[model samples]
Target: MIHSINNLLYFRQKNPGIRGSGISVNDPVLLPVLSELENLKTSLENYLSDKVEKLKIEISKGQANFPSILHVSILPRNQKVSNGIYVVMCFDILGRGILVGCAESITNPKGLNTVIRKQRGIKLNIDVDGLRPTTKYNNVFENPREFYFGSIDEKQLLDHISLSLDIALYNLGLAKKDDLTIAEKADTGANDQAFDPQNLADARTKIARQITARRGQKSFRDQLLRAYEYKCAVTGCDVVSTLEACHIMPYKGDQTNHIQNGLLLRSDIHILFDLGFLTINYKNKTVILNKEITSSYYGQFKAKKIFLPKKPSDHPHLDALKFHNEHEFKQG
Candidate 1:
């Protein structure tokens, strides 16, 4: 449901925007909206908004296949963005293109060339500040498109952008890489840890099997504590008995057994994390608390980065963090 302005539905007209007004997708109605987006761009990189207003915002419209596209690049500021990464938006004055736009991070270095345009995709987040229950799913952008144009709430549209950015980050190996120190991947399938038929003949054998299972659980806990330097990743609760090795992703076969799938949290935090009331935003390197616990002690830890393993190899896999964010982490 991530609606974009440049989606292939509009391709007939030639005029993308008003001329000499700073933007190529020339629509006076969207002036306020663009201003807001500029604010977001500056907030993201900071240096984009220096004391001098000498920032040259190179503006151009899409030609050939994309007639409705308005390509704006903030020049001399974000070399990473203005260089190859550009903000491509569809000016929706005619009711065909979407009001929401995207900041593309394409692989092409030269940018604006015809070849890169043909491939399509690579983007980020931008959110309107006032929209209570605002859309900040992954990478929280301070100011975004919904500041002005259109009727009704555009929070969903902004959320769609954040969601897309989350996916892109996961795919590009830029985020969500968690590696557990002590916990091993669980054998989640029915076949795994299934009692052998021969061993089930006696009650004593069944007891022994149960003991073995407990031992395996202990191993998982031991490894997690070691990975986290024997302290709770959340509260620094060093009480070994109170610490628990918890899985970020739910147990779902051998795939959950990987060490990167686990997190060493205090018992209370582990329970909360499992319940989706608490989570770690690995990209931001901070802890996130759901509304249910926002007023509690856990909330105090909000925006505070958690402790990670010392070794790079021990870092959790990026995919695991992404999974926890999308499917588990509760956010605005």
Candidate 2:
């Protein structure tokens, strides 16, 4: 039963694709004991160093190469210090052919919050680094509070650390077996529930705000990527990596992350569009270059209507576009 639960956790964290499947006899058996092996390895390395050294020597003498294994041990309910007990196993893939083991207890909200905070922070960090940045690490420290709460105390910290180590081992594939009986049962109930589009939309709104707060204008770029389906709305340039999401309204003026306020365009066109050198007229759905722009440079682009996937009613939020025309555009 313990092994089955371990496998379930592993499947949920690593192989999300297999999460809904009910446990079967054919399921892997080694998942639960894997963490235990890692824990035993760590204990031997620390308190029984001499024994570990002797074991390594013996293993090395064998003609076949010995693979490292790890064991982790979870405290039984009688000895558990928190609401949830966890253990981890780690394999030494490089040398020594040994495994490491560790365990921890997590009970309070603070402990759970810490895990959530770290995952959120790491996800945002990855997203920002993968995109563009104007200032040196500007987004990195913008909102530390958004990731971690102030209520995390030392006790919770210790609990979170242990749970995180177990999670890390699970991620590293050092567990014995998985058990997701609870999740499987829950998923069946969820499948029978009615869908709520409004809830999904609300979730998207929240996600957009979080993304915008962390990534700034790059968030708008992602919006454009989705709005235009990764193609340039004006020139039909499908070079996704080179495409830019241009805000019809200056980002400073309209802080909203509405998809309707953005457009996907080539990098050069994005610069022109933002500089008041160009404007898209909603009345006629045409791209209008300012007269001041020399004909030799922008003549071909003037008065040319953009090719957007959706109808005009679906994009360039009217209020936002009006603000840009009144404040940012260079009048003819």
Candidate 3:
């Protein structure tokens, strides 16, 4: 039943002179058990390998230096297990150890925790926020969850592990590596549309998170509103609460949050802007509609000029407008 070499060594270390006359370290009876363990390891590896490859991320050796382990960089650099080692999870004969770094980033951490507890009969030893720091493995995890092999069928356990990995990868996709600014971290918990349909209930959740960050970052929106005279740059809507601040270039750091790199737009227009259905021409500062939207209600704004700030210094930077037009604007 020993699937790892470490287990064998630990056993021998604890019991020195306990072998029978016919029982040696290399007993023939042990060979079949080791062979069966090897088959199990292969099955687990193959199952995980396919999942890893689909995520376009590679798996590496576990920092624990244990056999049958897999490590992935699902967390950001700050929360990594170590400087160069980002082992979010590791595997062994018993079961899996997951860092669960995305626990806070998930839209419904409590609900997901309840599901895991009910379905797997295992409760994550999580803090109030579903994240608890651990000094184990030398400060390895801020939030950790362990699932050991038990009465549950091995195949079922593996399936649950795979699903958990998918959830981690889904959050990882929303995380942009270039933008490590602390201001954006709160939005990381937004649900991945690919993982759940709840995203449709609040369609604005995606860009709204980027705009508001929902963590006392009202200054960014307030500044944009002041610069644009509390109006939607495109529609000229004067509702203060209905307008949002959007970044011309995705927020990379605090420096990118400048007024020149922002747009004050109505909620729906901000969604269209983020989705690339509409953009502003850098040269004339006129609204440019993607050809696909020319027949839609949005078509009226096709050559419409966007409202510009009175002070040229407060106007959207031409370079920022060019970047979006070239990179994000959908011409068709």
Residue lDDT tens for model 2, 1-332: 22322333343333221213223323454344344445433543453253233222111111121111212233222333233323322222111111112223332211111111122224332111111122112122211121121222333323332333333233223322231011112224555768775654564454344323334455556656776777887777876655766777656433654578787888888887888877777666677778888475667777777766555554777677677767787886
In order of appearance, the predictions have TM-scores of 0.36, 0.36, 0.39
- lDDT by residue for model 1 (1-332), tens: 11222222122123332222223345564454445445544433343343115234443233322222333344233345423333333333233333233343333322111111111143322211111222111112111243223332334443443333332232223334221011111233434666664433453344333323332444566677788998888788876656777887776544564568888888899988898888888686688888878887777887778888897666677788888889987675
TM for candidate 1 is 0.36
Best by TM-score: 3
RMSD of each: 22.9, 19.6, 17.0
Over 4 Å off, model 1: 1-215
Instruction: List candidate 2 stretches off by more than 4 Å.
Output: 1-219, 253-255, 311-313
Q: Where in model 3 is the C-alpha error above 4 Å?
A: 1-217
Q: Point out the higher-scoring one by lDDT: 1 or 2.
A: 1
Q: Where does candidate 1 have its weakest 10-residue lDDT segment?
A: 111-120
In order, the Cα lDDT scores of the candidates are 0.47, 0.43, 0.51
Best by lDDT: 3
Q: Predictions ranked by TM-score, top down?
A: 3, 1, 2
Give me candidate 3's TM-score against the actual structure. 0.39
